[model samples]
Target: MATTTESNPPAKDSKGLSSLNEFNLEKSILRRGLATAAEIDACKAHKAKLASKDESKGLLEIMVEARVLTKSQSMRLLKEAGEANRRVEIPGYQVIEKLGKGSMGVVYKARQTSVDRIVAVKILLDALAQNKEFIKRFDREAKIAAKLSHNNVVNAIDAGDVNGLHYFVMEYVEGGTIKDVLDKNEVFEEKMAIRIVMAVAEALAHAHQRGLIHRDIKPENVILTKDGNVKLADLGLARLTADEKWAMSEAGMAIGTPYYISPEQVRGQVDVDIRADIYSLGATLYHMVTGQVPYGGETAQEVMRKHVDKNTPFVPPDHLNTKLSSGLGVVVETMMAKNRENRYRNPDDLILDLKCLLQGESPMIAGQKPDDLATLAEGDVEDTSRGISEAQLIEVAGYVNGKQSVIVALAAILALSVITNVVVLATR
Candidate 1:
């Protein structure tokens, strides 16, 4: 274990001689104890070999071999990097269970003593404490997310650094991500898909109004709650345009997941704006409704290139699963248009279109001939009990008509008999 010291001794010779000798000796020891040039070179060679053998070994392994960070440290740094700012505590929040693990850190489900409520506690690795770039990015995530408050967006409660480890606390979303739902159920119906997408779009609009852009928008980042609500999480790569200090200074380094990246991001455009997010949202919606990505590539680089250079694939409802409506196809295609200008300009526009779609309106072209709702085939709708099918409604209507006819016939017969009886009594 490393020893902690309160302060360093003053550099002074008792005999009034120069203190340079002692300073030099200390510096020499520190330099020797640190990673040597030969060791760094060896680590690099090992990394190259590993990369050649297994392409799946993530970049974190290279950082670890260079003595820049340990495996645990790298994991922690990535986890805390994504969380919003909050106080870090040790032994403060009791760990109830581990929520999940990501590339950077492990998330724990804990109970905060102060509030007596459950929160997700993310712990960063101690090795990353010396990495300034990671620290800046980590802190910025919390600061940026804290500025925007929306029901659809996950809220950050607190952040802090404890000992050498950094951590952040966030509201615990009880349900899993949309990805989980999709894995279990391959595709979503038009109405259910529209509802989920609209919630996410509203959340994005709220953040956009605050000059915040969620750079990473994908199914994995969207959570579906048990209460039938959608929550947007993971704002680690989100950018605040209005804040000059928060602007990214790094160039050429891609910051988003390859599959969901926008064309602007793949092209390394520093001025990427809200439209990029619109494209990602479109891709997400496409995947949810059609059960496939807009484009498929064998490698990450190839995937990113497709976003920049290739046209989005045909996504008619019959293309993937025949159950989807053609109108849903049109909405996805419009949102995922290759040209940014052709896509929805803002989240508000997308949300409005989604709402219109849910209300049986033509979202793509206003005043255009509406599709025949009666001809639309029913797919497996999310069994939320609230979804009423046309077949069920028809059955109910038939039952009601039969009952009404029987009641009318019985009343007529009773009235005729009563009239006959009254005439007989008058004649008598």
Candidate 2:
């Protein structure tokens, strides 16, 4: 589910430590200040206790009694005390709330004061900031992601380390991930599913054109806006074509989530290119349509072996829902092909076939006309050799943005309804 992005060099402050370093330093100073103030308070308490002939407690006992530090925080501080420290500052953005945590870092939802925009800021955990490999990878990925500009891809706004903490800011998507949607509702209708996959395919096409391969593509990494625009997030695991050695090394070590990895990736082959992404996308599409992963096993190793050795299960459109068409099944099968050569040659081709399905044409048929493909209608299903019509394509484009707005509006209504219901019930 992790999204891969290019690493960028850390931004240098006037004093030279990265913004992440500065943030960490500020955090450390605050912690120390709090500790020192507590100690002084404890000393005063001890003096009072001695004068009153009462027993006095140590600093640790006082901190515990006051609930100054949670068990996790205490453990983290103990670990940090064993490491070296450095400090730096980021201008314009202030971390308002934490979004999520990962092995390498924590993601926060921050407000960018300069533009008055909300952004997702990822900061390397203080513990990992000192790891040379993690720092290099973080910088490299941030830089690369900053350079990319694609509608379907989450845009990177800034990257830097403050004090010794590395952080990067990206566009904040308000809607939940595809995984979240699926968790709430197991599967989607074929038409809706195709629309989502097509958007992701467009994103992959853009990234691949930039010579970057998103080694990880999954439902969790794909976010659906309230209006239904699907934006690909998290490019943390992406590898640049230019960094062959490093990219290959990372790929060889099993880079993707086990359930979504391609056969080539599971085999330890570092030469995987766009085709690997195609396979992963196919698996993702399959899950969206059927609510089941193509391959299943108890462990990472077992799942990886299944990816390399086993064939995808029989997943006809009728298997999950009788309303799905065989054409949609064909598209999923083509994507999930174990052999890379048999898969869609590129995302462009995958998108083309999806458009074909939208037009109600048999994607299996040959000699489709580009013009005919471009002239179909929204929600129209027809069998024609030309694929999706241009008009239909335009309608799809309109739907993307329009649907997103609708989703947002619907969410607002739902929230209001919940609040009203709560108030009424409470009053009664």
| Each prediction's TM-score versus the true structure | 0.63, 0.65
Q: In model 1, where is the ten-residue run with the lowest total lDDT? A: 366-375
lDDT by residue (tens digit), candidate 1, 322-403 = 6766666777766766656457778887777787788787675422212212222243222227675677567545754665
Q: Quantify all predictions' global Cα lDDT against the true fold.
A: 0.68, 0.72
User: Over 4 Å off in model 2, which ranges?
Assistant: 1-89, 310-318, 364-428
Off by over 4 Å in 1: 1-92, 243-248, 311-318, 364-428
